[model samples]
Structure formats: structure tokens, C-alpha cells
Target: MSALTIYKREVSSYFAQPTAYAIIVIFLLIVMSLTFTFGGFIPAGDASLASQFFAWHPWVFMFLAPAVGMKLWTDEQRNGTLELLGTFPLSTRSAIIGKFLAAATVWFAALLLTFPIVITVNYLGDPDNGTIISGYLGSFLVCCTFLAITMLVSACTRDQVVCLIVSVAVCFVMVVGGFDPVTTVLSRSVSEGLAEAATAAFVWDHFSTLTRGLFRLQDLIWFGSIIVVCLLGTSAILSAKRS
Candidate 1:
């Protein structure tokens, strides 16, 4: 419906310039380089592409996905078009969904651009293709999660730079909140259960669960819920702005 219309327009705008394409290329190059250097694909002696490829996705998307989504609404407001967009027949939620999908599609295209990594893994060893596929799925979900968070931040500001900084800060917190240092501090000051709960609430925990090819319904639910919540938050913010 109207969401589709906005989705089409958003997607078109991304490709109208070389920005999306350049981002995809740079993303692939950086991640792939990190895989070989930091991930130790060959030195680790792992048959699966786990550490080599998928391990860096969460960190990569932390910045890249925000870059993709930061301008979704900020640009509209900056150019004095958000009000015009609001007057359209489309619902606010629909517009939010459309913009989210558009940003998600750009990330999907980025994932596809790295097909050669899959091919390389195949050539190097008889890897578990099923696990590899699941990793891709998990990475996509994480990318969309970043986009949704970015959209929420973007909706609150017309300054794209502010949107980008705030998005990155939020994302960095979500990433580190699950790491040992944060959890360790939480455990010392708080109950162990509270520490565990805090760690579980972070995006990295859910993302790691899915990336390991553990398709738990709960992990999927966690990611899906984050996406929905962020989209609703964006819509609510935009509605207030419109009024």
C-alpha cells in the first residue's frame, strides 16, 4: 500500500547516487580484511566460516548500518519535506515501516555483495553450508536492528550528524553491554541474576545466539521485538512532530 510506495521511493533514492554502492563495497572489503587478519581464518584451523566471516558482522553493522539509516528522516526534516511527507495519505507507521525496509534492503544488498566469501569458504573446505546460511540470516537481522535503532534516533532530529553520533553511541552500548567487562562489573555490584539479565538484554547476546546457527524462537523473538519497538517509536515521534 502506501508503505510500498514509500519503500520504492526510499530504495530508489539510495541507488540514485553511488552512496549505497560505495558503502556496500567498502563494507565487504573491510569485513573481509578483518576476517583474514583478526579472525584468523586459516590460522584458527576452523573449517566453518564462523570466526573468519560472521564474527565481525555485529561490529561492522554498528557503524555501517547507522550510516545507512541516519538520513532516513533527518534528511526529510532538513529539506523541509517531512511535513509534506506527513500530509500524504500514508499512515505514520506505514512510512516508518517503508523507510525501515528501505534501509534493511540496502543492508541485504551489502550482504549479497559478499557472496564471494561464501564461494571462498567453499573452495577452502567442506564447510557446513547450513550453518553458513544461518549466519547470513542472523547478520541480516542484526543489520536491520541497527537500522531500526538509527531510524528511531533519526526521527528525533533534523541534524544528520547528531543522528549519527547518537545512533553510534546507542549501538556501542548495546554491543558492549553484553561483553565480559560490563557484565563483570554488573556482577560485582549487583546480583548475579541481574548481571545475567543485563547481558541478555543487549543485542550482541541475541545476535551471537543466532549467528551460532541456534535458531531459537526466543532469539528470533528478541530481534523481531526490537525492530517493531523501534519502528513504533519512530512513528510516535514523527506523529508528535507533525502535530
Candidate 2:
């Protein structure tokens, strides 16, 4: 079987169940609610999504992305289907990438649904289109990053709840580690070089950079490196289990 075959199967299975729909609804509710209420979308008087809209993406993805990905490998393992899947003609890497892409497609659809917000901003004010697009790109990358982390965690366990909890915890650290308040507190005690290194390794700086409409090569490298490392780790764990 090709990766495309596995991708189509996983995507079909996701939409066949209510899991994908529920997550998309919850994500929309939380993000839109926060955007208007706490995020001060209107009150901020900011034309760009950087401050009031995209700012909340990392926090939202820190939980929901893992929730969406928790079942990727955990369900197969729990239902004793992992071994059966391994017997397929496809490589373990193909299965991993297919499932990951399927999860990403669900989130991509959810993000696309938020286009009305784009229309609203455009109608209300002349926001920079390039910046808005960059913010959306950054938000999607944030979700993918969490999903990749969850894939690795899900491969290590059979229980979906355990996968969810561990994945969220790992994502939380990455988000919090780059937060200004947390960094400020730590920077006071730690050396500046160490604090800078920690921030660079985490998600906030790179994500914020993109949200600001600045697509740096290093930002792409950071997100890509973490994602590639996690997916490879998932492959290794599954391979060991299959053997």
C-alpha cells in the first residue's frame, strides 16, 4: 500500500466518526470566544491578528492538537491492530506520515473555517493581507508541531488518555518555556545565554516571528527540525514494538 492509500483511509475514518467534528467545533468555539472576549479583538483596535487573534493559537493547540492526535497510534495499539497494520505492505514511516497528514488535514479544515474572521477584519479595516496570511500559516504550524509531538507520545502508549496527558504536558512546557513572563523570571536566575538558548528551542519565538509577517529561515528550520525528529522517533518506537 502507498502512503496516499493510508492517508485516504485515515482521513475517511476520521470524518466517519464524530471525533473530528467535535474537535473542530470545540476549537472554533474556544478560539473565537477568546478572540472576542479575553483577546480583545475589537477593543485592541489592532488591524492585524498578531496581538488579538493569532496570539491565542499556541495555547489552544497545546491541548486540542494532542487530543486530535492521541488516538492516532494509541487506538491501533489498544485494539491490537498495530501488529496487523505492521503486516501491511507499506513501511512504518508511510503509516506514520499518513496518519499525521490526516490529523493535519482536519485542523487545516478547521482553520479554513475561520475565514469569516478574515472577512470581518477586512470589512472593518484594511489589515495587511500578507501579515494575516503569515499569521494563519504560523497557527497551522503550531498545530502541526503539537500533533507531531503527540504522535511520538501516542506510539509509546496504548492508552489514549495517557497519550493526551503526556502530549499536552510536553506541549505546555514548550509554550510556557518561551512565554515572556516565564522567561523573565527564569532569566533573572539563569544566565542570559542559557535563557536565550531555551527560548530558541521552544515554539513561541519562531511562531511569533511568522505571525509578525517575517518568515525567517531559522524559524522554519526550528519547526521543521522538531517535527522531523518527533516523527522519526515515532517510527523507531513502532519499529521496535513490531519486532
Candidate 3:
């Protein structure tokens, strides 16, 4: 009936299933391994873990966030509970916000678990804590954006698998929109302004700004705008179902 109640229920549901546990474990393993092995945080002469850690977040969230968010509305629709939920005193906007916050909480917990890496970096060398802090902020914002997109996609379908696939595709494009491969291909046939615009559309652009320990207002606004728009779209879809 209240936002807190909805938040608690959604968070509880995530932990109740094995999927959430599996995702968290896999996420940590992949991120840690990549950071040390490939990112060369251990052997590349840089004592700071920020490079290895933040570098993997965008890729990790591309898949893991969708895994967490795919069931938000799809499962309710599949099990015929969405209709009941719409009848509650809670507005659609509140329900969407509550669910988004719940999913974001899970992501925050996942990010917090990586603090040992942060501690390890501090133990090894005089790493910039400011950069590490900014990295966490960037990572969380990226996850929120991904989750919002997945939530909107989940609302569009009763099949969670379909939702997951569609969300992944959409998130992937957003992640690579700034990559050289993507931008290069676009540049060959498009105007420079158009190519730049394409590259600017990805989360990677805004995330890079934060990862540099520079808290740019525009980057925060961009990520926040995406979250708001996607969640608002999700609420609209659910409201249509209710009507």
C-alpha cells in the first residue's frame, strides 16, 4: 500500500530466488578476475584498483542489471498479479519508483561488496580515494539507468526471457554507442556532428566523466534524465494495463 511496503516486497522477492544470489556471485567473480587479470591492476605497475574495477562495471551491468530487472513487471504480468497490483491504493508512479529503488538497492549492495578491493588498494598504495568514490557513484548510476531500461522493457512483455533479451540488446547499444568500433562505423557514412551525437548517446561517455573523479553536473543530469524517462514510460504502460 505504501512505497516502503512495495520496496520491501520487491527486495524480498529478489533475495528469495536463487537467481539473485547467483547473479551477485557471478558479478563479483567476473569483475574481480577481470580487474586483476586483464585490466592489469596487479601487474601493470598501477597500484590503484580504480582502473580495473570501474572499467568492468559497464560491461558487468549490461547483463547483470537486466537479470535483476527482467522480472519486475514481466513476472507479475505472467502470473496475473499485475492486475491486482493496479487495484492497490498506491499510484502507478509510486509503484514504479518503489520497484526501481528496490532494484537499485540490490545493485548498491553488490557495489558495496567490492569495498574490500578498495581497502586492498589503500593497503597497497596511496590511491586516490576521491577517484574510488567517484567510481562507485558512476557505477551505481549506470546500473540505475540499465535497470530503468529493463523495467520499461519488462512492462512491455509477459515473457521474462523476451524482456531480458530485448533489454540486453537495448542496453548493449547504449554501452557501445561511444566505443571506437561503433563510432568509427557511423563516422564513415555520417556527418561528424551525427557521429559525435551517436557517441554521446552511450552511458560510457557520461560514466567516463565521473570515473575521472570529476563530478560534472551535466553527466548526473543525463543519467538522471534517462532514469526518469524510462521509469515514467514504464508507469504509463502499467497504467494502460490498469485501465
Best by lDDT: 2
1-243 in candidate 3: lDDT tens per residue?
Answer: 588889999999888978778888899999999998889887776654557779788998999999999999998899998878777787888888889999999998888888788888888888888887898899999999999999999999999899999999999988888777778888897877877897678888789778878898989999999999999899888878767
Q: What does the lDDT read for residue 83 in candidate 2? A: 76
C-alpha positional error of residue 4 in candidate 2 after TM-score superposition, expressed in Å: 0.9
lDDT of 1: 0.87
The sequence of per-residue lDDT tens digits that candidate 2 reaches over residues 9-121 is 88999899998999999999999999999999998888898988899999999999998999999999999888788887878899999999999999999999999889999
Question: lDDT by residue for model 1 over 37-154, one digit each (tens)?
Answer: 9998878777677667887988888888889999999999999988788787878888888888998999999998889878977887788888889889989998898899999999
- Model 1 backbone overlap count: 0
- Decoy 2 TM-score against native: 0.98
- Candidate 1, 89: how far from true, in Å? 1.5
Evaluate model 1: give its TM-score: 0.95
State the C-alpha lDDT per candidate: 0.87, 0.92, 0.87
| Model 1: colliding residue pairs | none
Residue 63, candidate 2: Cα error in Å is 0.7
In candidate 2, the residue pairs with backbone N, CA or C atoms under 3 Å apart (3 or more residues apart, or in different chains) clash, namely: none
TM-scores for every predicted model: 0.95, 0.98, 0.95
